[model samples]
Target chain A: MSEVIVITSGKGGVGKTTTTANVGTGLAQLNKKVVLIDTDIGLRNLDVVMGLENRIVYNLVDVVEGNCRMKQALIKDKRYPNLSLLPSAQTRDKTAVSPEQMIKVIEELKEEYDYILLDCPAGIEQGFKNAIAGADRALVVTTPEVSAIRDADRIIGLLGANELKKVELIVNRLRMDMVKRGDMMNINDVTDILAIDLIGAVPDDEQIVISTNQGEPLVGSDCLAGKAFENICHRILGEDVPFLDLEIKTSIWDKIKEIFKKN
Target chain B: MSLMDLFKKKNSGDIAKDRLKLVLISDRANCSPDVMEMIKNDIIQVISKYMEIDAEGLDIQITQTESEGNNGNVPALYANIPIKDMKHTGPAR
Candidate 1:
């Protein structure tokens, strides 16, 4: 059976969709059969983010409504043959499908895939509840900002309230330079506030935006953020990989060396 | 006073007592810094009920000592509400 993982954040625009896309692609890159389901109905953006928007003929609504078979709605990725996506209905609302319906859908898909990734919507409303109904574990994504960290902490509390045990943290958009200057909160500060195990820390990289815009996830060793995503995938598979701190280090030796070389 | 006498300032018990007194007052009056500022303004308004209030020099602050352990803990809030000179001395004034 596949392990259903939900990537969620209570606060909006905190890289939930990006983390979902990259992590799903990372798992697939590891030769695991993975399927990503976007549950943000009506305001669906995952398909567009994944560059699979044009290919979404039938979506989650069709499968739930019994208009089409589940296998028919699944869109196989051209880059990774083992990876697929089940896009949400762009015209329907969150109430279009019930939690039980999502659970049944995942239950059926579990037999064929090794991992089922759900890109959850923001806020602690029905959308959030429906997204995690069928998941085995949750990857709570949050940025380093105080508000985002507070919201993530609240969401973790809610997940604990829901009896969800396996909850991990992913700190995204971290600026190591700002952290060194004491201008932004570092990973330790965030972890201290939220009191959760850290699984991945993705630095703020311009390449991520370019890659995201290009509809190609950065997961290779060549891309810093991609390697971070791959490391997260490895951790998810029960591998203990040491986390890499992406913050820049400016030591006196390097500064002196730069001055001497310039002179 | 000897060097020890100079160090013989208030002990932990005394400090804790002071802190407890202030904390109790603040807790009862539900007074915070923000609330205290509003209260200071209200005090000025009420003092303007009878006498003039020096708003420029007026100061209101709450101080509290936070300590750990039962042996010696100084925890208290000290509020200093200082009002400047006014013409009024008595109720009649």
Candidate 2:
């Protein structure tokens, strides 16, 4: 069965775009046909993250407004043959697309792709509603911070209220070093407060920044965040893969590097 | 305070959990305060059918409790209704 999922985080800058890029890429790596839709109209970033920014001839608004077909708006990724991205319109606002329009677009994409991942914009506004309209489930991405958790709790309630109750939590940017010092919230602290089934928890890693800077999804790479994204894909595929042990065994060199960075 | 006392002080993680527990209960039951009035009134009407009750003393609100899912916590509705007397009813009609 085809599943349409919206990756959302109520607060902005909590790795929503990065999660959408990596998860979609990971799914494609598993040989599933996946299409990522950037629902953050007026501010597009999925294209850059997927390294397909220059190929965006048409956008979500073009498809919705009947200016172009869905295929014309979808930009195929260079690396993944099964992966594509439907970039949102930069000139148009969120009001350009309605929930009904979004649902219609997703239904068409459903027949072509095994999974349709929507990169939802921040805040519970019109864009958020449009992104989630056609989604069968939700993957809420949040960091291990109080502010992010507060917004995530609100998003979960909003998701339930909107009848999209099949939701999973992805705790991102977890720093195990800080967690050991009792300075940062751990997996249990987040899940206990959120009261939702955790899908994956990505450890804080600098490689994520490098990959994003290069406009590359790190799922195929060898790193903590990359492996976490791969594990998330496995879980999404119903493979019952266990969560990665994100214990950061700090070596002498790592401790020295941290000291240098702090200095 | 001694150095041991500093270590014994509540860690930031526990403090965050404590604060979020209190915040989310109100946040989750965000429809309270306004909807609470309607709920309290409806409860009074229902309870008054079976017994004379102290509607003024009825206290109902949202609180947190231990959850079953991986030891996580969830918001629970805590209702405290004070009953004045039971209305005597004859056997089923």
- Output the number of the lDDT-best candidate: 2
lDDT of 1 by residue, A27-92 (tens): 999999999999998888888788888898899999999999998999999999989999999888
| Candidate 2 stretches greater than 4 Å from native | A251-263, B31-93
Scanning candidate 1 chain A in windows of ten residues, the lowest lDDT window is A245-254
Cα lDDT tens digits, model 2, A105-155, are 999999999999999999999999999999999999999899999999999
Off by over 4 Å in 1: A248-263, B1-93
Candidate 2, residue A179: lDDT: 94
Q: Estimate each model's TM-score.
A: 0.73, 0.82
lDDT of each: 0.82, 0.91
If you assessed candidate 2 against the hidden native complex, which CAPRI class would it receive?
medium
Give a tens-digit lDDT track for model 2, residues B1-93: 799997689989889888887878888667668898898899888777777788899998877788877766667877899878776442432
Best by DockQ: 2
DockQ for every model comes to 0.04, 0.60
